[model samples]
Target: MDLLEAIRKRRSVREYTGEPVDDAVLRELIEAAVQAPSAINQQPWTFVVIKDADRLAQISRKAKSHLLKASLSEPAHSFREMLNDPDFDIFYHAPALVVIAAADPTDWAVEDCALAAENLMLAAYAMDLGTCWIGFAQNWLATPEGKAELGIPATYAPIAPIVVGHPRRPPPPVPRKNPDILWIDAQTHCA
Candidate 1:
């Protein structure tokens, strides 16, 4: 699929078939992520692929608490539910969990990591796999339990945890808003 097609068709998938993602396919996705551009070529990113069901659940449990408190409406609320749902755990039993981490130094590392994640999501969609960018886990991942469960070093920080698998439900294209919000000119809008 073309980049535009992938960008337009990609959706934040929550429901996934209980299918295992092949290592080769996962590698392809990660390669796309690594190909993303970084600030000043500081490609400070690391990925942790979690496959064990028990560990995935442990991480989810740690994250669920924060999700419950998040100020979100309907689908987002359902997102939290899906995370806690017995059937939803393991991200619908998708074979892999990828934790995105960046070196904790550069000021632009967050943006770099986010771009990498977006690339990964788009790549997964092109490959016909479902992907979800999980942010609620930040707090949980920072805790002792999370660190121990995910096996993170003291220096590395988790940027996001993405779930990947074959999508069970077909996601419709997300509507686009006006692009006028982007100002290309150098003229300042505010004094």
Candidate 2:
């Protein structure tokens, strides 16, 4: 698919068909992710690909439990309510999860990881695959036990937990908000 087409078509797919993504396709997505630019060319990121169905289910359960015990701030009320649903799966039963981590806890770590994540999502869309960044798993995946279970290094920070799979159906195009642009000419700046 063309770059623009991929960008326009990419959406946060919550529902998946339970079909496992091919290993080669998953590798290509990760390759696309790493191709993303990083701060000062410091490609400080690590990726953990989880394909085990049992482990994915376990993660969903743990994340939901953690979310329920979290403080009920007004902004989080809706999310808390969603977690209350016993059948709600944070990953939406996606067959694969690509957990992107910051290799070092630098100031630009999160930003760097975000760029890679966007690349991965776009690449997946281009390949007729679906992806959703699971923010609810961030806190839980960073905990000691979470890290140990996932085998993430102590120095690495779990930045993006993206679930990947085949979409049950292609989502219709959604409208985009107008761009907020501010153009300043060089001549106007020198007062």
Candidate 3:
């Protein structure tokens, strides 16, 4: 698929099928993700591919628990609702959950990780896979139990979880912004 088309078609999918993603295809997606440019080519990122259903469910529950404790009252309510929903999973039933972890807090690793994540999401779309960026995992990883549960080390900061699977339904393309709103080259001269 064309790059622009993949970028345009990419959406934050919430619903996914239980279809299993092939190892080769998933590896290719991760390979594409790491191709993104990084500051000084640090490439300070690692990924944890969570495929176990039990672990995924636990993560979902603990994440909601941590969010509630952090005063995220709304999410707590949402979590309660999700628990009862048949489709509710930490990763929305995606077969794979790619947890992005960045090293070095002051080295601008977050930006690099974001670029990589965009690559992964777009690549997945091109390969007919769906992805949802789970930011809630970040705050959860900061909690004591979440750290032990996810096996994230102290040196690595949890960035985002890229949930990968087959989309249950095609999502509509998001609206684009006006290019003029971004002033790329505002000519100014000082005397």
Candidate 4:
């Protein structure tokens, strides 16, 4: 797929076919992720691929519980309702999850990992695979128990918990808002 097409077509896929993502394909996606530029070329990112069904279900349950107990903010409230529901899987039942972590908790760690995540997502889209960043899992995955379960080092912080799988169907194109560009020429800047 063309880069532009992939960028435009990359939707946050919530529903997956539960088909197992091949190990080779997952490795290719990781390779694409690491190719993303980082601050000062630090490349301070590590990945934990979770494929075990039991582990995934356990993480989903724990993360949902954590979200339910969090403060009742706008988004949290919405997620709380989802947690209340018995059928909703926080990971949307995707077969594979690629947890991106920052090896060093620098100021730019989150930003650096986010860039890599975008690369991974786009790469998956190009390969006809589906991916969704499970932001709801972020806080839980950073906790001591979460880290221990995944064998993540104490210094490394989980930056993104992205689920990867085959889409049950192609997601429709979501409408895009107009770009809010504030272009300023040299003369305009000087003025």
Candidate maximizing lDDT: 4
Model 3 misplaced regions, further than 4 Å? 73-87, 179-191
Model 1 spans > 4 angstroms off? 66-92, 182-191
Residues 8-111, candidate 2: write the lDDT tens digits. 88999988997789999999999999999999889889999999998998988898888778776788787876898878889999999999999988779899
Query: In candidate 4, what are the lDDT values of residues 1-191, reduced to their tens digit?
Result: 89999999899999899689999999999999999999998998999999998899899998888878877688567666678787778889899999999998787989999999999999999999999999889988999988998998877899989999999998899999999998887667552
TM-score of 2: 0.94
C-alpha lDDT of residue 191 in model 2: 43
Candidate 3 local Cα displacement, residue 160, angstroms: 1.5
- Per-candidate RMSD, Å: 3.4, 1.5, 2.9, 1.2
lDDT for each residue of candidate 1 in 1-191, tens digit (9 for 90 to 100): 89998887888887777778888888888999999999999998888898887877766665776566667677677676566565545344566888888866588888899999999999999888899887666767766677667777867778878999889887777778878776657675755
Stretches off by above 4 angstroms in model 2 are 187-191
Listed per model in order, the count of residue pairs whose N, CA or C atoms clash below 3 Å is: 0, 0, 0, 0
Each candidate's lDDT (Cα)? Answer: 0.79, 0.90, 0.81, 0.91
Best by TM-score: 4
RMSD of 3: 2.9
TM-score for each prediction? 0.82, 0.94, 0.86, 0.96
In candidate 3, position 13 carries an lDDT of: 91
Q: How accurate is candidate 2 locally (lDDT)?
A: 0.90
Query: Model 2, 15: alpha-carbon shift in Å?
Result: 1.2
Consecutive 10-residue window with the lowest summed lDDT within model 1:
84-93
Candidate 3 TM-score versus the reference:
0.86
